[model samples]
Target chain A: MAESFEITDEMKARVGVESPPWTFEVTTTGVRAFARGVGYTDPVYYDIEAARKAGYRNLPAPPTFHGTPIYIPGKSEETFSTPLECDITVDHGLPNTIDGGKVTEYYEQICAGDTLTCVTKLASLDLKVTGSGITMFIQTIEFKFTNEDGKVAVIDRLKVINH
Target chain B: MAVTWDNINEGDSLPELKKKPSLTQMVKFAAGNGDFNPLHHDFKYFACEYLGSVLVQGHFRYAALGELVQTWLGHNQGGRIKKMSCQHRGMDFPDADITCKGTVDKKYEENGEKLADLTIWTEDNEGKQNSPGAATIVFV
Candidate 1:
């Protein structure tokens, strides 16, 4: 027995709407902790001199470190737990959400002190079938991060399923 | 530790890397990375309501894979990860030794810089792939 399904008209209209771009300032502690959290012990990710020796102005973030939204527009850290990374999410009243996958492409370096802007848009929503003959809805969202100088730094594409 | 262009070849393998992640490490990642998804923690929420046990996060696997690239290619070295992607196929727990491996699928020259495309995947002790994907790195 499966649960009931309902998608409100408001949610459907929200599709294709991009949330305002949010900005996150890269920091050393953030980078070092990000490196350590993943069990990476490279000095360049920790020490300033090591990073310079490696030919970087400062430590550039590693993959997936920026997956979560670290900043939001018009939000203060003192008021909220954390800044929401600007993203558009369509809630179609589908209780069973699925994880499809994530694709990340890097262009410029996300060095320390570089303020990056992240803009997200809903790409698609479609019906998918599972191996067990279950009907599912797939939602794909895309986010592009631009460096301070306006050059593209990275683009993260995420896909999820709603059942 | 520069991953010079001349030292790599097509079909070469990036050295394998393994990580025995701990609960504390996962928590730290959640706190630092700003991903406080309840699924990654909250014992009761994980055990009673969710996937039997607290599933190790997809970010952990992705981050570990990133570490493998940085450790092998050297982060500051001219080798920059142009693109890295992962598709989750299975659920993984925190208690397992996650093994990450990659193979150089092809090598070419782009914009006067050497580049390599890699086929990368992560598996558990059971040899079951939890996440599989591809990455392209450029060595300048």
Candidate 2:
């Protein structure tokens, strides 16, 4: 909890800055792992035959399961497995963080055997103080995932609150 | 039967998806989503200790809501989720029932496509709506 916090000019300048593209892979194993994690019993998410019968070229990624980022030893986040090259650093010296919310818009069906090039941009930043007198820094990041054909398939807006 | 745009009414309620996530399931989610946040799986993590127990990841509930929509749409059919959004309002602990429910709010067409907008949410064991959001689905 921060007693006093503000979004400085430097922080505002970070908005709209696009990060370098990173590779995200949607493999059969990745799709099945995500399906199993979500407790899905749908065979279309696991069986290639079932997926084909359902009109999908391959195992379909679950609605919210964006493909996993290609992980490298030092270039990826140790915990999240996200590529560090696309991370926008905001020098907000906050000690605590919380998940504010998320919005995902899909333009195409994401399936296994597809490779996506993902880019992220700092969309916006705001500061809010609660009635308890604790200041919070709210950051909204936009991620765009484009498939091999250079078509944007998924866009995700993630909100993070730091206090 | 599959839920088609023609068959679903504006006030129709989707079948509820009930989830009871365990510690092992949490770990699997951490692996599946690549979010190895210790507060979700490690009870001894400092944040978990502060909260008195390991908390379920917000994305877990988001994915469950996705499952709810997908199951209703019937994967064998050609329905697609055009958009889905959610806000994390409160913390949910593991081993508790999380009920995902939805109600169709509107039905319309755009550029020759049939669409239905629905309000969706997940409720904890006490019936408190912890995650509330909306989704738009397109029918073939």
Candidate 3:
């Protein structure tokens, strides 16, 4: 638990610094899994034939369902399965964190068989104290998903609250 | 009938999508999203113990709201989501109803594409808006 917290100059400097690019893959099985996980009954997310008939080349990724990151043992976060290299680590001493929110912007339709090169940047950092007197660090990270053809397909902003 | 820019009007409400996510469903979401965070599943995890129960993944609600929009769009026949955003205002527990709702805020033509801006959210069983959001969908 964080008794007190403040943003350091070093942490502030890390904002806007882009991390090394990582690969995120959109696959038929992955889209199906995510769609099923979300309890979607839409056939376009499960059957390629239905997807094609619906005007998609392959199974379409459902809303808010971005491609999964390529995970590598020893270089990935075991708990989250995210590439460790893409993390903009802040030494905020909070031990617990929660998802505060998310914002996703889509430029192109993301479908199965597409590989997106993703880059993340720390967008902003702020410190807040809750009504219950808990100190928290709010960090917003921006992710850019660029398709194989080099066109940016998606931009996601995720806000994480660490307390 | 498919929803089109010509038919959709401002202030229209989307058909509500209700969900009651079970623990097993949460596990499936964990596998699909690769977020094995114990706080979401392990009952003995510190955060879960501190919070009194396993909390639902915020993304789960976000995606639920997305599902609400997709269902209204006739599963791609009406249109596609161009932008979606949400703010998690409070924690939600599993096995409880999370009702997704939205209202069309505006409709306009931009750069030859017809688009509508919507105010979206997921409310708990008590009618408390736990996750309030906004979305933009383009008519195909």
Candidate 4:
């Protein structure tokens, strides 16, 4: 069942309102496997000492690692399974939402041994019916990551276009 | 390390980047980015629903721009990207070759730092702009 919503400017305005904080732990094996899964061989993503030598406090997860959790919503806890990066909205009966795009500013380095809490909120939604008879709803979502110190490490604005 | 700034006027083009869209490359991106969103990997996902065929993930093309910035500016070493944004203008289907592109719209000094105002995008097999965006690069 594909669920459809009436997208309006008000809906876009309602985007980014934070939901309950989703807390998760990322391990070194998790980071390495994820990096390998993505074809990124950057040692900083897997090797702790390498990351430390690279000036990162701990083995750092890749910039898009935060995306995995957001995409899947709720699924597995372990690291190296079938990297299920599917969108959670599908559970809501929505199909794939294309990312119109995003603008990411990496403020602080995310290091290993740090348990980060990801806070997500609905940002906005715009309904566009293409000339080709396809209806694309552009939904914007925002994610914020806070470390134990309450320092906001990363703020990501994700734009997803789903029908 | 600081990004070297040259006098780039409006209408200047950055070095263009070329790539091919492949299922194997798509899988690599899925593995590296950890974004195996099935819509990207499963042909049936597309065949049965949208587009009637598999399409490249939008981010994969944008990643090419990120790669260009890394290759040219040397990753985080190029000072700060400050702000960057792009939109999906078209689609790049599988097995099609494409190119990543950027242009210097203007150059100026801000907050005592040199900056380049630029536009970027990816072109599909037919030489059409697929993903387009603008960026501000600050040099130390």
Scored by TM-score, the top model is 2
lDDT per residue (tens digit) for residues B1-140 in model 3: 77788889999999999888899999898888888988889999887888889988888999999999888887557688999999999988989999999999999999998999999999997889999999999987
Question: Candidate 3 at residue B86, lDDT?
Answer: 98
Q: What is the per-residue lDDT of model 1 for residues A1-163, given as tens digits with 9 covering 90 to 100? A: 2233444577677678887877766888888887777877778878989888878898767777653345544663422224444446775665676577888888877777677787878877666567886767777888888887899888888888777
Q: Candidate 4 - CAPRI tier?
A: acceptable
Candidate 2 lDDT (Cα, 0 to 1): 0.91
> Which segments of candidate 4 are over 4 A away from where they belong?
A1-16, A24-96, A110-115, A129-135, B5-13, B46-53, B75-78, B109-114
Write model 4 residue lDDT over B21-120, tens digit each, in one string: 5788787766655555776778676452666666787877766676555445544554446556678877777778878888878788877978887788
Ordered by lDDT, highest first, the candidates read: 2, 3, 1, 4
lDDT of 1 at A72: 42
Model 1 chain B: lowest-lDDT 10 consecutive positions: B46-55
Worst 10 residues of 2 chain B by lDDT: B71-80
Worst 10 residues of 1 chain A by lDDT: A76-85
Ranking by DockQ: 2, 3, 1, 4
Model 1 residue B94 lDDT score: 69
**Model 2, residue A139: C-alpha shift (Å):** 0.5
Candidate 1: true contacts recovered, fraction: 0.66
lDDT of each: 0.75, 0.91, 0.90, 0.64
Docking quality of model 3: it rates as: medium
**TM-score of the B chain in each candidate versus the native B chain:** 0.89, 0.95, 0.94, 0.84
